[model samples]
Target chain A: MFQSTGEIIDGVAKITLKGELDAAASGQFKDTIEKMAEQNPKKVVMFMEELDFMASSGLRVLIFAKQKMGAGVDIHLIGCQEPVLNSLEMSGFHHSVYLQETYSEV
Target chain B: MEALQLPATLDALGPIRDYVSEASKKAGLERKAAYNLKLAIDEIATNVILHGYEEAGLSGEIKISFEMNDEKIVLVLEDRGKPYDSRRHEDPSEADLELPLEERAIGGLGIFLALKGVDGFDYQSENGNNRNVFSMNRPN
Candidate 1:
């Protein structure tokens, strides 16, 4: 199962992801990214501490968010588990976003 | 050896991954090895469901089986959806991996990572079935 919740505040968007993010869950994640993009947040942060698994589809959605939010917006992925971190690293997506143990505005 | 058969659909991914986890535990694989095995299986399984079955307008079942011996643990996934050879796809090269997000192509990334994540990966098409075998050496 996959669940995602998001909110935009102070020009920053925060989305919390839980459960597995597989092919079936990518649509939901994409939808959340789309909703968050509409608000034009300057920064996007995804809390992925509870995300147990992520398939290639999830990576695609991250790519989508980057393209949707454009190059100006910074995307931060915080508190990712090792498995998820492995996925990002294997696909070389770790370079595309900021990975942090905690999120603090610069 | 242990085996399971499930429908080739997105919904089966979670259960399929759970089965991998259990097999990894049973085989006493290290955490990183187990995670890599699961990721490898999940990627190919996703391809089988999405490209082999759904995109082809076909429906079938995926059979997953595993064998553990003194040297390694090998997992096999067989599906009748379509004949797919992941090796045929161009793997993302180091240069591709270095490309910026906007320039990177999403296609083939999954199969690339899937092949790279495992210690051994082989694909064979026989008797109208596509079989993907992933194996990892047991840490001594």
Candidate 2:
């Protein structure tokens, strides 16, 4: 199961993603992105501490989020597990998104 | 051989990943090796379901089999959708990797990752089915 909760803190749109992020769960992530995009926040930080798995479909949504949020808005991925991070790095997506060890660290 | 058949859909990928993960662990694969096995299979499986079926307006099933040899675990994914050979496809280039986010094309990234994450990747067509065989050797 994938769950996402959104909140605005210090003018940043923060989304906490828990559970696995596979093809079936990407739709919900995209929907949350759309909602956050509507708020037009300057930054969007995804908290992925509990996201244990991520498929290519989930990666595509992150790509989509970058496009939807536009060039001006920054997207940060925090606390992604090694496997999930490997997918990003292998596909050259790690360069596109900001990756931090922790949300507070970024 | 342990075989399982699943409908060719995006939703099937999650369970497929789980199945492969457990099977790899049982086969005595290390944590990273098992993780790579799941990633490689998920990438190929996603392509089989999306491009082979969803984009092509076709429906079929993906049959997966897990077999263990003395040195390696072999995973075979077979699908009846349109033929696509991963061997013939061009992997993402190093120059492409250096390209900025906006300029880089995301196309073929999945296959690139799949091929890189596995020990070996082979593709062949047999009896009107696209067969992708991926293997990972046990970590020494």
Candidate 3:
């Protein structure tokens, strides 16, 4: 199961993702990213504390988010769990995004 | 030993993961090992679904069988839609890992990680089906 919601706050797109992030859910995540990109937000922050699993398809979306948003827009990941963090690290995605222990820490 | 036959689609990934997780645990794999096994299976299954079925425009099924002994566990995935060998990619060098993200190839990274995470991997094609085998050491 998967659930995600997005909102713009102070010109930054904040998307909260929960549940397992398998291939089936990646399309929805990419759609959220596209929707957020349309707002031209200066930054995109993903809240992933509740995310339990992340498949390769989910990592692919992170790549898509980077390409779609361009270099100027920063992407922050907050509160990544061990499994999801391990997936990011395995694919070398940890180097491409900023990881925060908490939203306020960023 | 146990087996599963699922459609070659994204929706089947979750159930596959669940089955692998349960089987790995039953085989005496620790948390980390079980997690790696699940991740490895996900990578290969994603490849099968994307390259095998969707890209080939042929719907098919992926058959998975798991067997465990005192020392190790083996997983075999059989697919009929297309032929792809994940072992074709060479192990990444340190310099390769240092490359800028945009400069790196978009695909194969997942397979690379999956290969590194497991104890053994093999691929073969026979009778119009691609068979991928993965093995991991069982925790003492």
On TM-score, the candidate that comes out on top is 1
Which docking class does model 3 fall in? medium
Q: Per-residue CA lDDT of candidate 2, range A14-91, in tens?
A: 999998876678789889989988888889899998998777777778777888878778889999998888888877
Please state how well chain A of candidate 3 matches the true chain A, as a TM-score: 0.95
Which scores greater on DockQ, model 1 or model 3? 1
Candidate 1 lDDT by residue in tens digits, B1-140: 45889999988898889999999998889998888789889999999999999999999999999998998989999999878988788878898887767676666678877888899989999888999999999888
**Per-model TM-score on C-alpha atoms:** 0.96, 0.92, 0.92
TM-score of chain A of each: 0.96, 0.93, 0.95
Runs with alpha carbons beyond 4 Å of true place in candidate 3: B90-96, B99-105
Q: Can you tell me which runs of candidate 2 are displaced by over 4 Å? A: none
Interface RMSD after interface superposition, model 3: 2.0
Interface RMSD for each candidate model?
A: 1.3, 2.0, 2.0
CAPRI-style class, candidate 1: medium
DockQ of 3: 0.49
Q: Weakest 10 consecutive residues, lDDT, candidate 2 chain B?
A: B99-108
Q: For this target, which candidate reaches the highest DockQ against the unseen true structure?
A: 1
Predict model 2's lDDT versus the native.
0.83
Alpha-carbon local distance difference test for all models: 0.89, 0.83, 0.84
Model 3, range B1-140, lDDT digits (tens) per residue? 46899888887888888889888978988887888888889889988998889999999899888988899999998899789888887766766666545555555567877887889999999888899999999878
